[model samples]
Target: MTAHYFIGIKVEKSIRTKLTEWQNVLAKSMNYKDWTSEEDFHITLKFLGGCSDKTIDVYKNKLMNEEWPGAFRIAIGPAGYFGNPKQPRVFYADAEKPKELEVIKLEVEKIGSELGFQTEGRTYRPHVTLAKKNAEGMSPLALESYDLLLDESYSMLIDHFSIFRIHPQQNPKYEAIAHISLNKEE
Candidate 1:
């Protein structure tokens, strides 16, 4: 079977729990499909379309060898709706440091290209999607606006990175096919 793949930041359990709680509340205020499970939630760094097993292995090696600059603190905020708010589509928590995040994003895209995967050339904006539209009507909400406060801030210690393959099925599963753990003093 063909697999859909992407690169993402695997959040620690502690951070995941906190983000989930906040997401639950925000999801309730919007009309959207609930996430399959908390485990399925992740911040995608790159979308690496489809690839053969050989290609995946080659990219996995590259990712394992690439060094992270250091730990970066992501201050997430600026809640807003995407598409048309009336017939609302996506609700997201915007990433504050677009330039900094783009640096990493570009590197990941480069790796994906090296692996013989299609890399998108579109402008990137880092955001955690809170919700997506469903059959339900738009849930009216007063989206909170702020000067990029830390709705949930954490230092993403870049010791490791992973590549996951997404299954094609209802409530699809994501399998981590490869990872590179950084040797940093924790």
Candidate 2:
């Protein structure tokens, strides 16, 4: 069986609406023809895509035993894009000097790799993805006019981390298979 797993710092539910509003503004500014639903939004720490159930359990147990640094706080966005502006591929909520986030990512990558999960080669830049454009490309008008509106920017304390199973073509789709508290004494 194939399961897509990721270690992610979950955005608090209270700020979900604010985050969604930022996305909506960007959609309007960039004139994004395609729509990205709110459920897809999250800042990925590590992507451990497609693994056996045994592997998943091993990772979960490992997480349960480790202690996180602390209640990490992250402020999302003033707006950003990945790839060339003229040929933009992704729009996202940019993290403001996210060194703590980088540290968290490195730790997860190290632990996951030690557990036999091959880590992603790309460098981590924490972000909440807003939209995606296909290989066919976006319109020049859309590309040039893409001004990311981040008026809804806010920060939240990430008290825990979660591992989710991503499945294709299903409602109640992504299930949180595991969670690890950031605070140990709590």
Clashes of each: 1, 0
What lDDT does the true structure give each of the candidates?
0.63, 0.69
Q: Which 10 successive residues of model 2 have the least lDDT summed? A: 134-143
Total colliding residue pairs, candidate 1: 1
- Every model: Cα RMSD to truth: 3.8, 3.3
Query: How far in Å is the alpha carbon of 156 misplaced in model 1?
Result: 4.3
- Model 1 vs. true fold: TM: 0.76
- TM-scores, each model vs. reference: 0.76, 0.81
Candidate 2 residue pairs that clash: none
TM-score of 2: 0.81
Q: How much RMSD separates candidate 1 from the native structure? A: 3.8
Best by TM-score: 2
Q: How many clashes show up in model 2?
A: 0
Kindly list the per-residue Cα lDDT of model 1 for residues 1-186, writing each as its tens digit.
556788876655665565566566655554466453456655678877776777777887787787754455565454556787654577665655544456667888887776666778666767666567654554344445522232546544444657888875645366777875644655
